[model samples]
Every structure is written in structure tokens, then in C-alpha cells.
Target: MMAAVATAALLSGCSVGVPDPAAPSNPPISSGPGTPTITPGHDAGAVAARDMPFSAGATLAHGVPVGLSEDLAKAPQWKQVVSNAGGASRYQKSDGCQVAAEVRQNQWPLVAADDRASTAALFAYLDPTVLPAYLKPASLRWGGERGKPGPAVDVLVLERAAKPTGQKAGRATVVLARVFGTAGSSVYVSASCPTAAALAAARADIAQWLTVVPPG
Candidate 1:
């Protein structure tokens, strides 16, 4: 239906970057229950990917968490969207911070047999030249903890910066995406915030899902 389709188009808040500037007070779109996906695991401290029954916003057994309404204090809970690639969910906290997540299939390899290349790719995010223009004033780094999400190549991009004194309404821009999937697929989860304080506020809830076991 038109109503259903209209709601599906909203963006998930997957990152440490700015997602939107105008909507400083609203969270991303969220809805729908989901099933978890399995990835390569069993010996790498990550359990084998498995499918489990999850409600509209439950923590995934192996994939990124979605549809988490209980975390938010009031109405307008997590909104979810599903498709062939995978699914995504978004939610906004009453305090103006928002979190979002997504899992999608890919044609190219994401978790390669030898993660050397993939590891390099994750490290590339730390390259100063590759970062966004706005991030020039900000400092970015990857999470120190490794051996997560099973045998998949993964990285949790982190950033810190002072509240912008120049940008208007604190344009949302930083999104530190982590892909947790198999060789060719990925799940992008992010906490998009307008300021450093906002991002810190949302970090605890967002990390609960993003830092879970399995690739995506």
C-alpha cells in the first residue's frame, strides 16, 4: 500500500557521520520485526550465525540489532524496512540522538577467506586524507577490541570532536559504518548525531547491538 511504501523510504542512522542536518530533533525511520542471519563462525570466539525469532525490535542473535522500541522512552519507536538485500531499522531518542542499522547482501566479497585486504580496507578509514571535509577538525579511530563477530572482517569506527561552533544547526555528517556480514554481504549500523554530546548519549544503546557477535 502507499502508506506502507511511504514509511519504508526513511534512512537508518548507521554511522558517526552526519545523516541529516534539518532533522536535529527526530530519529530515523523504524518498524517491523526481523529474523537473524548466520555468518562464518564457530571457532573464532563468535558462535555460528543462526536464525532466531525476533520481534519488531529485538536484539538479533547474530546480526545487527533492529526495531528496538524499549530503548526509546516514548512513542515513534524504531521503524524498519526490508528488501532483497536485507533490512534496516531506525529510531530517535527523545533527547534528539538517533540510532539506525542495516544488513544487506553484496555481490562482492565482504569477509574474504583471507581478511588481509578487508583489514586494510577497514584501516583505510583512519587515513586522514580519505575522511570527509568536516572531519578534518575531528579525530577518527577504530575500536581497539578485535576478534568480534566471529571470523568476519570488521571495524568499529569511532570519532570525537568539539561541538561545532560554525556549522548551522550542527549539520549531521559523521557515520562510522561497520560491515558485519559474510564474504560478500554487509550490515551497516550507525548513530548519527548533531553534536559530540548527542553522539555520546546514544553510544551506549547503539553499541549494545552493533558490537554483538557474528558478522552482521
Candidate 2:
């Protein structure tokens, strides 16, 4: 029992800001079979400013693609976090990032770019209710930043699992956070089963993904 608990604690990683800054990489292994697969895809199309229907402005992160807004529509499994007040846009991760895309919508603004570190921490520390118990998160990876000064961009991912609890309890959920700077848009994706042999697995992908996106 103690070994299991220790293994879970070691699974979580912390890779914010500095991208893949040689952070902790390896995720805890399950008693089950092999590692999960990640499939990549192109952005769907542009996320029209007018269509936002919620906030006013939306900034693009430094990296990432152009048509991500629309691509999210493709990810049907992604579930938006429910909130009463109208402030930020929201999206959820479905099928993990590889094959699955983001889905859902809301009118919330993205957090500031410099706040990337905080964003990662927030996902890492998400309330158990919002996320599944088995979905253990280790670190947060960059998505994109808005504006020149750098507002919170789109997409932030967590590395490994802390323990096991959510739908993916006993498994790792790569927490993904997406923010729309202008239309107050935001989305969170809990990518599951991150498997890297080294202590730096999460950091490598997190940094690479952040570089792929552009500001909204």
C-alpha cells in the first residue's frame, strides 16, 4: 500500500512557464498494459470574433495554430466546466489531444499570459469534483499567450497524476486549460494516461504543444 501511494505521489510533474524546462518527466505506471497513444491533427478553422458572443476581445498565444477555435468543435467528448456567471469561454478535452479535439463554449476571458504558471498550478490543483478522482495530474504545459505583453493564451496541460481518483483514477490525466483572451473564452482538457519513462516526459510534450498554438 505504501509503495502504491509513493508511486502515485511521484507520478505528478510540475512544468509551467519555462516550457519543458528539464522538469520531472516520468509518470507512474498502472498494473495494466501499455502506455496511451497521442494522435495529432490540424486546427479546424477560425474562431470568429463575433461568434464569441460573450466577451469583447480575444488575444492569440505566441505559438499554436490559427484555426484551433473551430477544431475544438470536433472534440465531442470534451466537457465544458459549468459556471453561472458569464465571463470566460470554456472547452473540454476529449479522447485526449492526439486524436480528440476540444468541444463546448462559454464567455470567459483568458488569464494573463504571464499567469501561465498559475494556470498550470490551478489545473494541477483542480477540485476533485470538477475532475475525476483517478485522474492524477503532475504538471502544466503552455498553450499560447494573448497580446504582445502576453495574456493567458489557449491551452494548458498537466503532466502526471498525483494519486488516483477521477474517471481515470489510478491513471494520469494531462490537464489541458484553454483561454480565449477576448471573448472571455476558456477550456480545460484532462488528457489521460501520460506515459514517459524518464522524469522529463511531461515537460517535453508540454513545451512542444505550447509552441504550436497562436493567439486567438
Candidate 3:
């Protein structure tokens, strides 16, 4: 399970910001698997300023990363914590679950000269040489789904080994989906949970939110 989690972290390196030199230093407290550490002083204003090309208004989906429905937003269990100028948004659930969504101008051209270069970079990151021993038993699957322009989604699941204490093993799952539209617009969403039940609920919420196209 840790192997799958590590692989997903590498694939979804989503943090975007310049560290604030003056910000206080604080260590991250692990809430559970897949929770991101919160940095005290990161300047995300410039990134947020980049047009999201989507609406941040309310939606019907509960605990979604996109425009959260009013009822859910107002509910005691979920809260919106981050809204960056880079068109990135995040929501948190009381149970330590999280949902985040973002739309950015595809920087592939600037990152590399062409698709080949981009693919090379991606392959290098996912090189099998670095995968952990536990990954041998993990399952990975990917497919394309229809969206305004279509998005590619990947699902990974790994069953953990029993503890030395002989307790039952747990499971972890990650779902990474992204869409790249014409004119440089790209939308990406990721949801993860430590258990099958939590992952299922998270995936359902994400699916419902993804259906609402953000206004350009």
C-alpha cells in the first residue's frame, strides 16, 4: 500500500508555489495516508491569478473539489480551506479526507519542446527501477472517459501486508484523472483514501463534480 501511495505522489506532484522566506517553519502532522503537509508560508497568489477558466460557484456534488454545493459548503463536516489565484481549490472533511481541483494553462510547451519530451519526463519519473518491492502485487489500471474534451484516468490499488503484531492488513487506493482541452486549458483531479469504503465515497463525489464543466 505504501508503494502505491508513493507512486501516486510522484505522479501527482500537485503543489505549486514559491516558498515564502519569512514564513514560520512548522512540521507536518500526518492525518493519514494521502494527506498533504501544510506549509505556513507559501506564496500562491501569482499562481492563483492564472485564469482558472472555470466557475468557482456552487454545485450539487457534496465534498467535491470543484465548486462545492452550498449545503455541503455550509455543512459542519466539510470546509473550504484553500482558494489560490492559480485557479486551484481545496476542501477538507472532518474525517481527514480531502478533495482538490485545479485548471491550469497547459505548460507542456514551456516544460518541453514537444509531446515526446513530456512523455520522456513522465516515463523517467515512473521508472520501474525505483518502484518498491510491495509494488509487485499492486494493480494499476487506466482508461479514458468522455468529458468536454475527454480525460484520462488511472486507478491504483494495493493491499497491505499484515503487521508484525498479526493484525489484519488494510488497503489503499488512488485515482488520478485529468483533462486537457484545446487552447491550453487543463483540468485535473485526484482522490485517495486508506480504505475501500472511503475511496468509493470519494470517487463518487469526484465523479459527480467532474460532470459540471467550468465556464471558460
Candidate with top TM-score is 1
For model 1, where is the 10-residue window of minimal lDDT? 1-10
Which model, 1 or 2, shows the larger lDDT? 1
Candidate 2 C-alpha lDDT tens digits along 1-216: 222321222233222112222324564668987533221332222332212211312333223222223223233443444322222223334333221223223222224433343333344443322333333323222233422222223344434543534554444434455444332234443333333332134333433333223323
Instruction: Kindly give the stretch of ten consecutive residues in candidate 2 with the minimal lDDT sum.
Output: 48-57
Model 3 Cα shift for residue 191 (angstroms): 1.8
In candidate 1, residue 141 scores what lDDT? 17
RMSD of each: 13.5, 17.8, 14.1
Q: List per-prediction Cα lDDT, in the order shown.
A: 0.35, 0.33, 0.36
Compared with the true structure, the alpha-carbon lDDT of candidate 1 equals 0.35
Off by over 4 Å in 2: 1-100, 110-159, 162-169, 194-216
What are the per-residue Cα lDDT tens digits for candidate 1 across 1-216?
Answer: 111111122242222221222344565555765433543342322222332211101122333321211222223433333222335556666665555544443312233432223322432432423333222111111222323432222333434343368654532323444333232333344555666776675665454333323333
Q: Which lDDT tens digits does candidate 3 get at residues 96-145?
A: 55655544543222122232223222322434433333222111111122
Off by over 4 Å in 3: 1-76, 108-171, 179-181, 210-215
